[model samples]
Target: MTQHVTVGIDGSVQSAAAAEWAAREAHRRGLALRMIHVAGTEADALERELGGGAELPGRVAEICDGIAAAWPGLDVTCEVQPGHPAYTLAAASGRAELLVLGSRGLGGFTGLLVGSVGLRTAARSLAPVVLVRAESGRTDAPAAATSADATSADGAPADAAPGDVVVGVEGDRPCDAVLEFAFERAADLGARLRALESRPTSHDVYTTQAPVEQAEIRESLAAAEQVRLQDALARWQDKFPQVRVEVEVCPWSASRALVEASRGASLVVLGRRTARVPLTGPHLGPVVQSVLHHAHAPVAVVPHH
Candidate 1:
């Protein structure tokens, strides 16, 4: 089947944001956009029909219709599926280029952009899953687009130059899948790629070593970390020559470093390391959980071995 970009919609501010972001992405990739909402029971269906909330299917269709109107030639389609929301979305991820979900700032100031279902869907998704934060007052309309008509072929505001793509990589090893997605996205948008590698906080070179010796050991370790970062990115950099690369060897924690870099980023790419490592399902790591809690931009979690 032809690859497409999919976004899960529930008629919330966050879901609206995800739909717009997904539209732009689909436009950029020259792929069709699929918007889906999962409602499993008669009660759920009745709630949509009567609750009058954003989760209503008709409301979602109205939103999709508006986006399709804005992007004349963009192929936009909406579907209401029947099943467990999380499992349904996770299954949808397997068929699309990537699945996008709205981050309603779930957990408020304490945690995740996505709610419980979103978290489970993201963790279990076969392919990558992107979480988009909802902008206040944002709706089905084109308000989120930059000023000056807020319409462009790439589905972004005309003057809205894309932001840099931030990706986290381990100093000890490289994940080709994650790097590939990051570099490809950078190349597509002509955005810079900021690769981050955090050095562990524990700089315990030795217990009895003098301060000077400890300092030297720290310097040596930092150097090694830098080398590893370079080694990890060398091949990807070559593959995406047009993508400008910036390497950051952070002195802070991995989650903190990535979260900081996420500021104003077009996208933040992370590798999903899990014991199962299967397409069926996998749980999120602690670092991924923390970053999800705090990232300021859309976060892409790519499943990999």
Candidate 2:
């Protein structure tokens, strides 16, 4: 069966770009395209007054029309909803094969990756979420050239597979679920899977340890941590021998490590923290927010079991 991809459109430029990217992806994957507009609190009164008439639903239709025009003969639907954008988005993600959105919304001031609805949605949604950001002309243009060369050099078909799936592997046990989800996605795409892990730095070690003997002890503890990361990767390797898996172990912050890994990756995978846990909500957490904001690729946040 064809995949079903849904993208939230708020009539913003970033959302429009997301629509365009989602439409292209839907066409490329032979999937259905859905355009959704979640009416914000500010727009609730307007929605009640207009009731699916022009401006609200009409704008959504325009965005969908643009997508349809770009990829003629593609499945497309437009919808306008009332209530919180994030709640509607999270609920819509339940049955969607994939969810696409822009990094920043109609709001103002977008830095490299500060904060936005895209980050929140990516953190909570069970479905894989793609955050479409403006791409650099020079880097984005070389895809055709690189693809052609890849096929010619390796005897690999031009469309041999889809894109690489990147998953974050922390020392935390919950990351096991993240690895499993990413491996499954890689299997589906016939793409490679990359597992990235980040450890604390030696500088932090020096600061925390005062005595020479204590410093040595801390060093040993850090080394053990790295060893645990290797063991985790080994388990994944044992489970999915056929999948091409690349493991990255570093001593940087988890967010920075993920962002670096996501540079050329098609999707970034993360594990969601439990709500009952302290400082584990979708919007909070350093590593979660960092990867969501900074990574150029789409992110897939899976719940911890």
Candidate 3:
């Protein structure tokens, strides 16, 4: 079976943007694109607006047509499923190369940046889920345009140099899946990989100790952290020699550091740990949640043990 890129679609602008992003990714990866629409909830109303039943397929067809137009030569397919949106989308991830969804959906509080369906799907999906906001714009652009013209207000390129992938490293529980995904993406794009490790400052040690002791303690801790981070990345770095690796060790909140790094990143990769107790449900860590809500680039939430 050919694994294709999948995106959950409703009538929302965000989902439309996700479909476009997924189409571009599928084309770049030489894979097909699947646009999935789960019936029920707000989608039912959308179906009705599109004339329902026979006419509903037209709406999906229209979306597929637009994607085909945007990404010529790319294979695209559409499906309408009947079930809870989150559960259906999560189940579809099992067979997809990657699952993409919008950060915000239609049936949610205005202030909630990420909707419940997207959150639940990201937490439960076995495959990596990429959350794209409408503002992410069309990712299918010429290399020159994407690398040089997409700029911030200050006239700096919005994305990482030309090809740069950023992955957040958790020292306590470094996820192999996340690291592998980052390295693989960088290798595929012939890009550079940046591994970011963040640790909270030891405020107590600094506050209670003398200046000399503080200097010694801080230096000691920083050295140990650098060594640990290098050890964690050693095997992977060796595995992908083609990918130039850069390691950043920061004394700050992981979320803040990752979010800041994402400003110029092609993609921000983070790990979602499965809940030990199934009944407690999926546990998306604070860092992952914060990055998803704030990162400027598309965020990939890779689930790992």
lDDT of each: 0.79, 0.67, 0.77
Q: What's each prediction's TM-score? A: 0.86, 0.70, 0.82
- Give candidate 1's error at residue 245 in angstroms: 0.8
TM-score of 1: 0.86
Candidate achieving higher TM-score, 2 or 3: 3
**Residue 270 deviation, candidate 1, in Å?**
0.5
Residue 32 lDDT in candidate 3? 89
Candidate whose lDDT is highest: 1
Candidate 1 lDDT, tens digit per residue, 1-305?
Answer: 67799998876667878887888788778899998988865666677677644344666666676667666667888877878888999998889998999887534567535678878988889888999887655444542332237666655444368888999988577888899999999999899999998876674546554556777777777788887788889988888889999997989988989988988899999988645756654788888888887888899999887
lDDT of 3 at 89: 96
Ranking by TM-score: 1, 3, 2
* Model 3 residue 202 distance off true place after TM-score fit, in angstroms: 0.8
Ranking by lDDT: 1, 3, 2
lDDT of 3 by residue, 3-120 (tens): 7999998756677778877876786687988889888677576766777863335445566666665555667787778889999999999999999998752224434778778888
Window of ten residues with lowest summed lDDT in model 3: 140-149
